[model samples]
Target: MNANELTIAEARDALAGGELSAVDLTMACLTAIDAGTPLNAFVHATPEIALDQARAADARRGADAGALNGIPLGIKDLFCTRGVASQAASNILKGFKPEYESTVTSKLFEAGAVMLGKLNMDEFAMGSSNETSCYGDAVNPWKVDDRKLTPGGSSGGSAAAVAADLCLAATGTDTGGSIRQPAAFTGIVGIKPTYGRVSRWGIVAFASSLDQAGPMTKSVRDAAILLGAMAGHDPKDSTSADIPVPDFEAALTGDIRGRKIGIPREYRMEGMPAEIEALWARGREMLADAGAEIVDISLPHTKYALPAYYVIAPAEASSNLARYDGVRYGHRARLGQGDGIVDMYEKTRAEGFGKEVQRRVMIGTYVLSAGFYDAYYNRARKVRALIKRDFDEAFAAGVDAILTPATPSSAFGLGEMADADPVAMYLNDVFTVTVNLAGLPGISVPVGLDAKGLPLGLQLIGRPWDEAGLLNHAHVLERAAGFVEKPRKWW
Candidate 1:
């Protein structure tokens, strides 16, 4: 395989064996990124920074090397990389270079990973498709009928970069299916560890409670290796869980015998495509063949998860984004002659935020308004609790994991939904929002293809803090599916 095409695990082994140097791998990725610029996967390119890190990794070759030694990876723009522009794909934070690194990225660097650049994402992670990005929509590497498809969002660029072989893997944050949906769309592996499993210290907040950082890689094993380097408790983030970080790669024994996998009845929504249903059925049979027991289950409150998530996520986003007024860091509007402070605030925000972000902020502010708080936000919180309880009940009944379709459908064209209702876009997350609402671990593994030759993915939802087992089960499924198709490089 080409150096740029190597997975994290493969690259790490080659580097350690002296078969490949870190500089060669880094340059190969840089070349791929340069050639794939039409995809708009990366909003920023840090070739110099990548080379410096590669040289340093080369120097630490012998006994001092770390687990991720000499690995080249991409950082999501949402991550606060010190001295790098971390804009989160929003114009409000354009040119805002943080002075410190996020805890997750810091841990990856400590393990000797090199940063290629910052990948694109939805503006403030507010959209299901990457169209909300201020940096222009990231085109999926996968195409159908010569149409440019979307690489789901808000982690679209991470998924695109990985699928296109621009990087070994990339950082991604899941806020209501951002990571998993995009991974599904682009035929890659993405895992959102249980909330608090990975620190959120310097990641730009979208919805404080639901957003969790994870890895987007070329394979299940690569996801495991990257997750190990990214997961750890951080004192800087109060929500970070103080738990033992396991060797995620070592946990992939692929021995899932006797494990009970749940097929949630609620996931079988009306109008679900026959292809998705067939894919789900195939995933069940694969797991059953691997010695896992398949059991019918019901997450009764699943219907309400999407509604409750929209309410709660937007409410938290409104509060969290209030800090972006022109007074502090990030872009500020030029004051007009005789204009008041209110005018500056309004104009600056109006110019900075995208349409989708503004809409959510308004929805959030209205939901949290004095007269509507009890009716909307508070009610949503109660419904959120019930959703969590539903998952809890399922786990208590011996369901080791839950399997479902990762996305409602395969990737759609980039502008297909532009004129459609916003709620239509929101429906894309119907299969994914419940996992974020319940704060559990979820992974998307590409298993098959849709009618148009686009990839389809199966999601595996696990109990809190049980990522090791979740990854093991996913590994079994991946091996059974054996999907190795790559996008024909039309870009």
Candidate 2:
């Protein structure tokens, strides 16, 4: 029945109709996992435990199961899972299972979703490529003439697991393109909600102000279905907005016809690969063909977004990572005689955090330090506000959404750019960072593929709380573009 390729909604319907059983679905996923674990796609799998949960879900189906009842999903290790080893792909947190489950996972459980296991991610969700994980990175399921490819990060494992049909839909977090980039790499639908739309409670902090958990699904509607179950406010997270949740599933039916989509002129800059440029142009045409009016807009402060986000997110990450000082959590370095409490903290952080994490922490601390606070941190914040204002102006000018390329190029090899200078690697995030700085909702859906046969994706940026509008346009574009992304043995 190709259970691996079924959408989350389809799997649930099959289970409900008795055409499939929770145990049957779980077994197929476990079988796939057993075959793919050597690919390093998962950090851990609880098949026995997963089967137990599946049994419970099936029992509930016998009683009055809901839409998502009995579907198994892969959870990114960044989310806290009680009793499941919830390490954020780091060495220090090894064997340090959390005592509680994250809000998102908890909500999914209430909706009757089962967990296959914990998927891999970059340590502390730091790197763009999952190569920085304490565990090995996830290999892309897509192949280009026997050559290995990449599943983007820090949600690469989630993307790869879903692509490999190891799980239905997986949870992902996008601080600055983590979710969307990986989705692009694996040809899946990834949506990062407007900041504060999803509760941050129980998520291991990376860049606190920017960290947002979302869904990675096979279809936009499935993404909406999963998101509907995950979105809500929680008193535990102070930054959570108390806005009423909408039925995103119902909202998907709204038409984006006659709507306005703006193409930020600043985004189409020099050095953009030809394929990406073509995809962006094709995206605008697709929207236009679907009755959307495409406008040429300017965001002068757009170029400053990457720099500001690099500074701001690192600063927040440095603060959020301070809790991993070996006493309250994670690993702690041995204290020496005559050394004060401060030394223990310093040594612990040095030993616990990986190289990339330490590099970011130092950069963050330096920028937010007393000497450079105003010149760097404060100025960046002001620039961030200006960037958001740019979006505000565009939205006010009748732009319902913005369209752009998801990446400058398709997925590269596993280490294709690892040593070609970090600046180049960081540059890969150029297209997705601005959306984060504006605190807007953004998604990446497969638009087409490059000549190398790697997947290419289009990014959709939306106004705050306008996710419904964004998804509607995305679905319309999906059909209008006729971008069928069936890879020949790609997954």
Candidate 3:
């Protein structure tokens, strides 16, 4: 296999056996990134930094190497990589490079991982499709009838890069399905750990309460291997959990026999595609054949999840994004002849933020306004608690995990929903937003394909801090599904 095509586990073994050097592997990925520019997955390529780290990793290979030693990984632009451009794919943060590293990236570097560069993302992770990015959309490698598709956003770049062999694995954040949706669209594995499992410090904030970092990789095992390194408590982030991080990869025994997987009745929504239903049924059979029990359950509050999420996420986004005024850091607008500070703030924001971001901010501000807070924002929080209660009840009933379709459909074409109502786009997160709302670990594993030959993914929602078990069960599904199809290189 090509060096860039090797899974994290495969590359680790190859490097350990002296068959491949970290420098060679990093260079291979760099070469692929250069040649795959049409995909727009990598917004910046740090070949010099990558080689320097690779050389350092090479020197430490004998005795001082760490868990991710000599591994080359792509960082989502949302991560504050020290001395690298970390714009979160927004014009607002133009030319901004952090003086410090995010806890997650810092941990990865401490484990001897090399940084290839910054990957693209939806501006502040506000969109379901990658088109909201200021750097432009990251094209999905999978195409149908010559129509280019979107690797779902805002982690589209991470998913696209991994799927197209531009990186071994990349970091991604989940806020209203940014990570898992893109992974489902790109035919890769993406996991969003329970809220606070990964520290949010140094990550560009979107919806602070809902955002969580996780790994997007080629296989479930790779997700496990990377997540073990990415997770842990951090003093820097108050929301970070204080629990001990478990050995995620080692826990992948793939023995899910007797595990009860719940199939939520509310997930079977009106107008859901037949292919999605069929695939769900197939997933149930696969798990059942593997000796697991599939039980019918109901998350009665499911209908309210999307609306509540929209309200809560935007409200937090409005608060978290308030720090981007022209006075401090980032892009500042030039003052007009008689304009005051207020005008400067307005102009800077108008020029810096994209349409979708501005829209969300406005909606958030309106909802949080004194007059509307009780009706919208406050009610949403109450509904969010109920959503969490629903999951808690299911788990309390002995459901080990919940099984459902990762997405309502397969990868859709770029510009497919350009002129449509925005709610039409929000529907993409219907199957995913609840996990974030309820603060549970969730994963998307490539299971099959749709009629157009694009990839489809199945999601498994797990109990809080039970990522090891969730990944183990996903490994069983991965092996049973045997989904190894790769998109033919069209970019």
**Tens digit of lDDT per residue, candidate 2, span 235-320?**
89998899988888787764777899999999987889888898888998888877889989998898998889889999998888
lDDT, model 1, position 43: 92
Q: lDDT tens digits, residues 355-446, model 3?
A: 99999999999999999999999999999999999999999999999999999999888999988999999999999999999999999999
lDDT of 2: 0.86
TM-scores for every candidate against the unseen true structure: 0.99, 0.96, 0.99
Name the TM-score of candidate 1: 0.99
**Candidate 3 Cα misplacement greater than 4 A, ranges:** none
Q: Candidate 2 vs candidate 3: which has greater TM-score?
A: 3
RMSD of 2: 1.7
Candidate 1 structure quality by residue, lDDT tens digits, 367-455: 99999999999999999999999999999999999999999999999999999999999999999999999999999999998989999
**Model 3 CA RMSD to the hidden true structure, in angstroms:** 0.7
Give lDDT: candidate 2, residue 216.
95
Give model 2's clash tally: 0
**TM-score, candidate number 2:** 0.96
